[model samples]
Structures are given as structure tokens and as C-alpha cells.
Target chain A: MRQILHILTQPNDPLAAKIIAAQRQEPDHQVRVADLTVPEADYHALLQEIFSSDSIEVW
Target chain B: MKPSWLLIITSDPRTSARPAEAIRIAAGVGTWKKADVSVYLRGPAVLALSEFADEFIDEDNYTRYFPIIGEFGRPIYVEQGAPRLAEIGESPMRYQEISDVELAALAARHNHVARF
Candidate 1:
């Protein structure tokens, strides 16, 4: 499965979120969200993992 | 050079000072740390493109550091969405309008991403 990273900054940007979820639902891809707009406590760790991973596709 | 910073210029002209500060940061960091810096024009930042030949020549003008973008071995990228700014028209550099998804991917490719 491909690990896709999405940095979502807009609450209005459902497309971005939906894409990530779709990827995750399918075995072909797994979506991880950074939730950049309102960075949560774990956002930094999530970002570090995604950025450090080579198999991750960021959007 | 390590990698480029996807600099976004989306602030108003009166608020151009904010971008100027960002430019200065790029110049200083690129010069000292050998950073590959790339400026991306988005939203209101597209206005910087049209200011190409204006008072941009002033050293005190924050734009003076813009040339440093190229000097430091970085490309000044413009958004393709901003139709008003064309290299031939008024904006000094070329622009590309990429999807927000693509922008995110770009930010991902870089080692560090900072927004201003």
C-alpha cells in the first residue's frame, strides 16, 4: 500500500481530506493527514514521519 | 545548497513589507547556509511580479534581495493562476498556476517548509 500524506489547511478543502481517506480505504494507498491549518499537538510528529518516509506521497 | 524554500507572496502591497522580510530571511539563510531558495507567487503575492521594474531597484526595497534568489541558484516561480502577471506584461518573472495538491507535494519534497 502506498502511504499518502496530505497537509490540510482549509476546513473548506474537503477534496484534500476526501482524497486522503479514499487512499486509506483502498489497500493500494494509506492516507495520513497533517492537519496544517490548526496544528494539533501530534501534528509535528505526524509531519516528521511523513516527511522522513520515502514511500509517502504528499498533497 | 540543501534545498529550496517554496516562498509564497500573497500579501497586499501595503503589506508587502511582510514579504520583504521573508525575502531578507531567504537571502541571509541562502547566503550563509547555501540554501536553494525558490519563491512561489500565490494569492495576493502575485502583485510582486508586476512590480518588477518599479522601485524594486532600491537596495532598501525588500525586493533587492529578489535577485539573490537566482544568484543563490534558485528559480523564482510564479503561479499560473495569476493571469494578470506575465513576464512580458509587467511582472518580472515567469509564473505557474499549480493545484493546491501540487503545492502540498512541493512542500513535502522540500526538507523544510515555512509559511509567511
Candidate 2:
């Protein structure tokens, strides 16, 4: 399984939604979406997780 | 030695005053703190360059603060592709136009970056 991380800076960003939908269609991909509009500590933790993932996309 | 800082202000003053206030205070205090500062206005933040900026009179009046920033010998840059750029052609205030690549280069040159 491929691990994919999506870092979205804006709330309800359309691009992030589209990417999530596309990844959901792929059965072999595990996709996670991290909204960067959160608190700084939460954002750092999410970033750390993204660094550990197989692939990452930022929007 | 003072550290160089890139202050990227991308918030719309129409929506909230927090971002404008943040830039105002940063530029105001950063100068006395002896930090070399640069400002880049992008997105809705470019609207701050319009003549309408003078009408913005709050307790922190960002319009007034901007000139103080310039007096501190800090270079202010406006993004070439900012939506409001054409509406306010040739800002009365001292600012240079920069492309996305140039903006990236400026950020890379700075020791630290703060985005509003």
C-alpha cells in the first residue's frame, strides 16, 4: 500500500478535496489529509507525519 | 549581528485587521530590535497599497505604520501577479515589483520568515 499525505493550507480548499477523492478511488493507496490552518503544535506534528509518509502533496 | 527577516503579508484587510496589525507591529518593533527586515505584499494584502489605505484609521492604523516601516530602511516588495496590482498602478509608497521566482529567492536569502 502506498502512503500519501496531503498538506492543505486553506480550509475547504477545492484542490485538496479533489485530490482526496482521486486517492480514495485508488484501492491500494492510503491517503491522509492534514489541514495546516490548525494550531502550530498540531501543524508541526502533522508535518512530522508527512515527512515519514511515502509521498506528500501540498496545496 | 542582526538577523534578516522576510515578512510575507498575504492577509486581506477587508476580512480582518489581525494580519495588518501584525505587519505593523513587526515592522515597527523589528527596526528597533535591529533586525534587517523586508516585506512582501501578496494576495489581498496588495490592497493595502491602494489610496483607500489612507482611510483605514484604527487604533493601529496600518496605513501610518507602513511609512514608518519604509523609514526604517526596509525594502517592501509587491508581488507582480497580485490581484489588486493593476487597480493601484505604481503605488505612491516606495515598493518594488517582484516575480514569484524573485520572491522565492528573497525568502531563501533571509535568516527567518514570518507570514501574516
Candidate 3:
């Protein structure tokens, strides 16, 4: 199963692209990002997706 | 250097992308201590590299946000985000060539990813 790492919350333009460059480890991983205008539901879904993973912790 | 968590974004997320009650807490420097800062700029926010820059339309021409960052002493980087800023010219920040493959990899490396 492929897991998605949601960095979408962190990117707002160049940063999103930058984060896209810096993160992610293996092939089965995915990174999602957003901009000035992202739907609330979509954002929440990203977090929920992570929680379903082996574990989800925000520090 | 402080234990930085990696700040990968173009403009100040607080003022540029996400607008909150002005209190999401940055990773040190301004009001906090023990915060290591490493910012990377790319995409649209890259435009912020020149954001809020003082342009002396009077002088030949100079409009960019680097001067402010320099004063603030924040270590920021610009990659493809630089070329997106202008057609051509030297930007104050250094540019890093990023790819989808690279971005995906970075997301997994950081402890957390918070876009503004």
C-alpha cells in the first residue's frame, strides 16, 4: 500500500515546490500540497489519511 | 546551528499564504528561542523573494525582498522559484533545481510540513 505524506498544508507557492524537493523517501510515498485557496474538506481529508497510517504525530 | 525542522516555502506563510490571528508561532528568531531556521523558496511564493522590496524607481531599478531577509538575518533559498520571479537577472537568494521526484523525497524527510 502507498502512503501519502501531506505537506500540502506547508506549501503556498515556491515553498510547496521547495518542500516537494526536500521531502519524501521511497517510491510508494506521496506528498500533497495546496495554495492560497484550498477547500477545507480536502485539507481535512489529507490529515485523516495520515492518521490512518501506522501512526500520525504532529510536533 | 539550532535543530532546524526545515522551512520550505517562498513567502512568509503567515502573511502570504495562510492568514491567521497572527499567532501560529514561527520556529524561533523573532520572538522565540531555540529555533533553528532553514527556509527554501519555490513556486509562486518565490515571487516573495522580491516581495515587499523597496524599489528606488529613482535608481536604475531594484525591487526585491532579499534586502529585508538580509536585515532579518534569515537563511532563505530560491530554486526554480527564482526564474519564476523574473524573466532574467540575478536574484538575491540562491536557486536550487527541484524536481517532482526530489520534492516527494523532501516531504518524507522532514519531521513536519506546514505551508503558509
Candidate 4:
């Protein structure tokens, strides 16, 4: 399965929700979400995820 | 080798300060870092580099950093299906139109990717 990273810059973004929902159902994908707007988000870890993920979506 | 940084600006400048901040960050990275920095424009952010770009300025941060960005002379890549694609024709800045497939490849190649 391909690891897909979803980076969210907006809180409760509807489009991001829709895309993540559809991707979650795919058999060949493993989805991970990182919310950048949140206070607890670790920038270094997120940067590591950005380079490691097979696919990335910023929304 | 210098790390490659891909800065993607997808926010609508007229509606939010994200695009302006994105531009400022791009400029900062280009100016201060010993890295290869490139910008990608798509969605509403494409308009931020158009001839009517002045209209989209956040007024809060864009006005101060727009000129600084020019000093770096980094290539600004615009997505093929971006909104207001026509308005960006022959932009004074170094602008290149690219495909979504290419954009994906670009992000993969970059050492870091930041989207706004």
C-alpha cells in the first residue's frame, strides 16, 4: 500500500475531508493526516513525513 | 548538495493572508538559505502573480515582501489548470506553466515541501 500524507492548513476544510474520506477506502493506500494549523503540531516530524510519504496532498 | 525546497502557494490572496505569508516565506528562504528554492502557484494563488497581482495583495504582508522576492529570481511554477491562468500570461517574473503530474514529481524530488 502506498503511504499518502494529507497536510491540512485549514481547520475543518470540507474539500480535505472529502478527499481524505475517499482515499481511506482505497485498498492500495494508507492515509496519514497532519494538521499544521494546530498548536501541538511538530514541524520537524511533519517535515520528516513530507519526505517519507509516497504521496502528499496539501489542503 | 543544497536541499531543494518546494513552496506551494494555493491560497487566494484577496481573501486571506496565507498567500502573502507564503510569498514572504519564499523570499526569506531564497534570500537567507543555502538551498534551491522554487515556488508553485495553483488554484487561487496563481492570480497572486498575474498582471493584476496588485489587486490581490493582502496589504498586510504582501506589499512589504513582494519586491524582496524579486531579488532572489526564483522560478515560479504555475499549474496548467490553475484558476485565472490567462491573467498570468507573460508575467514579468520568471514564470513557468507545468502539469499536475510534473508538480507531483517536483514535490517528490524536493527535500522539503511547504504549502499555503
Q: Report per-candidate TM-score of chain A alone.
A: 0.60, 0.78, 0.36, 0.91
Tens-place lDDT per residue, model 3, B1-114, is 443344455344323433111112342233344544344556555544443333222111122223333443544544543455683345555445555555445445444444
lDDT of 3 at A50: 61
Give the candidate order by descending TM-score: 4, 2, 1, 3
Give the clash count for each candidate: 11, 0, 26, 0
The segments of candidate 4 whose C-alpha lies over 4 angstroms from its true place after superposition are A1-59, B60-64, B70-74
DockQ of predictions, in order shown: 0.15, 0.06, 0.22, 0.15
TM-score of each: 0.60, 0.61, 0.44, 0.64
Which candidate wins on TM-score? 4
What TM-score does structure 3 among the candidates reach?
0.44
lDDT by residue for model 4 (B63-97), tens:
56666666666567887776687766655566778
> What level of docking quality does candidate 4 show?
incorrect
Among the numbered candidates, top DockQ falls to 3
| Residue B90 lDDT in candidate 1 | 51
Question: How good is the docking of model 1, by CAPRI class?
Answer: incorrect
lDDT of 3 by residue, A1-59 (tens): 33434433333444345444544445555544333255554656665666654212121
lDDT of 1 by residue, B77-110 (tens): 6555665454335544444566555655555455
Which candidate number has the best lDDT? 4
